[model samples]
Target: MNQLFRLPQVGEADAIAEPSADLRVPFAQSGTFVCKFIIGEPSDQAVCCGAPVADGKSWCAYHRRIVFEPARPGRAR
Candidate 1:
């Protein structure tokens, strides 16, 4: 039945919005990091925000508008 397979209520949101995939940075040694957005239902998209860091601290980028160093001259991420 549709009810059995239906997904649980996520939250009050119309649709979850995508995150800025382009905003990526270098992760410590050789790895890379980037900011990501956690989409929810259709009513609210700002479910969660975070940036992949080397240390492993997933902060909320939505509430704490992330401010990273501008990409070098030509490089953009």
Candidate 2:
């Protein structure tokens, strides 16, 4: 079989570059947006993700990865 792929080669310049805020998904809903990850039973719910969002992000760093990055092949959500 023919080889079809090669690993990505990131350079120092690429790593040092600042990520553009425009690439992030915008939060359109009113009020403060929090990580949708819930805690406790439905009868007693709470928002314990972290501090209020900074830089106009929708979810925390953890949830942000889940929202943007593509899931690995053969892996369950």
Candidate 3:
């Protein structure tokens, strides 16, 4: 059973070090739009989900759904 759930391979660590370019949103001059997800060692880096956000919210559409949406009754997560 343990074989069904395996840890990430050694080389896989590097792949997760940086977010994909496609997922990053272009920074605006005023810097009004910024992702609430923080990255980096000191936790200073922020993610840009490449999309607009709803009013009165900090995270982008993707993050908002993951962070705020309620889990389904039969879902594992």
Candidate 4:
């Protein structure tokens, strides 16, 4: 089988890199310009990537690619 992407398994979300202090923002501070990707545990302490989002996108280029990865060609099926 040919795989174009590998989705992270459950409980692996916490492996996300620690967001830099300057690039982290509380959920309430997120907006069109801030990456909407949530990081950290779901709680008042959680933050979103405050990195500048890609043009016209709610997430930064990195996160966008993770969420919208292209599907693998299915000819192998």
Candidate 5:
């Protein structure tokens, strides 16, 4: 069972490091339209998702879903 969930290989692990291999822009380098989705902890040192935002929104669609939990119709507030 452990084999089914092996730890990441050498190169794979580096992909998720700070300033991700996907070219995640640091908060300093970010433009207004970029997603404000923080990836890690320590808000001051955290990195944003760096994807474009949804229309007139602070975060991208993916991050929007995470940040805003839509209320279920029948659920009590």
Candidate 6:
């Protein structure tokens, strides 16, 4: 599979070194933008599949279909 595009952190001078793959996309850090798992919206979902979550995600394991990989194609399947 081809590598997926992702948004890099904003306001970072070093970010210019490796420009973000997608600039139109914006990530939420809390509430609606934040993952439901962390906020306890749904405990049954598996956002990262036992893997450390990123900025926003909702899930732990044996639940939702979100998994994290080094070179993830894109969001979870």
The predicted structure with the larger TM-score, 2 or 6, is 2
Best by lDDT: 4
The full ranking of all candidates by lDDT, starting with the best, is 4, 5, 3, 2, 1, 6
Ranking by TM-score: 5, 4, 3, 2, 1, 6
Go through the candidates in order and give the clash count of each: 7, 0, 0, 0, 0, 3
Runs in model 3 with CA error above 4 Å?
A: 1-20, 23-30, 39-42, 69-77
Candidate 3, run of 10 with poorest lDDT: 1-10
TM-score of 5: 0.59
- Local distance difference test scores for all models: 0.35, 0.42, 0.45, 0.69, 0.61, 0.32
Candidate number that wins on lDDT, 1 or 3: 3
- Model 3 Cα lDDT, one tens digit per residue, 1-77: 12232246433533433334565643332145555443333322444454444474666545654566543334553
How many angstroms is residue 10 displaced in model 2 relative to the true structure, after the best TM-score fit?
A: 8.6
TM-scores for all candidates: the values are 0.22, 0.31, 0.35, 0.57, 0.59, 0.16
TM-score winner: 5
Tens digit of per-residue lDDT, candidate 1, span 1-77: 12222234323222434345444333222133333334343233333334444444453333223333323334533
Greater lDDT among 2 and 4 belongs to 4
Please give the RMSD of candidate 6 to the true structure.
13.7
Residue 2 displacement in candidate 6 (angstroms): 9.4
Cα lDDT tens digits, model 5, 1-77, are 12233345533633533333374667767788877677777466677778765486777766666677754435644
Question: Which 10 successive residues of model 2 have the least lDDT summed?
Answer: 10-19
Every model: Cα RMSD to truth = 17.3, 9.8, 9.8, 7.3, 11.1, 13.7
Q: Tens digit of lDDT per residue, candidate 2, span 12-49?
A: 32343323333332223224654443333333333334
Candidate 4 shows a clash count of 0
- On lDDT, the stronger of 1 and 2 is 2
Better of 3 and 6 by lDDT: 3
Pairs of residues at least 3 apart in sequence or in different chains that clash in candidate 2: none
Over 1-77, each residue of candidate 4 has an lDDT whose tens digit, in order, gives: 67454456423643556446688888886767778788767787778878875587888766765778544556555
Whole-model lDDT, model 6: 0.32
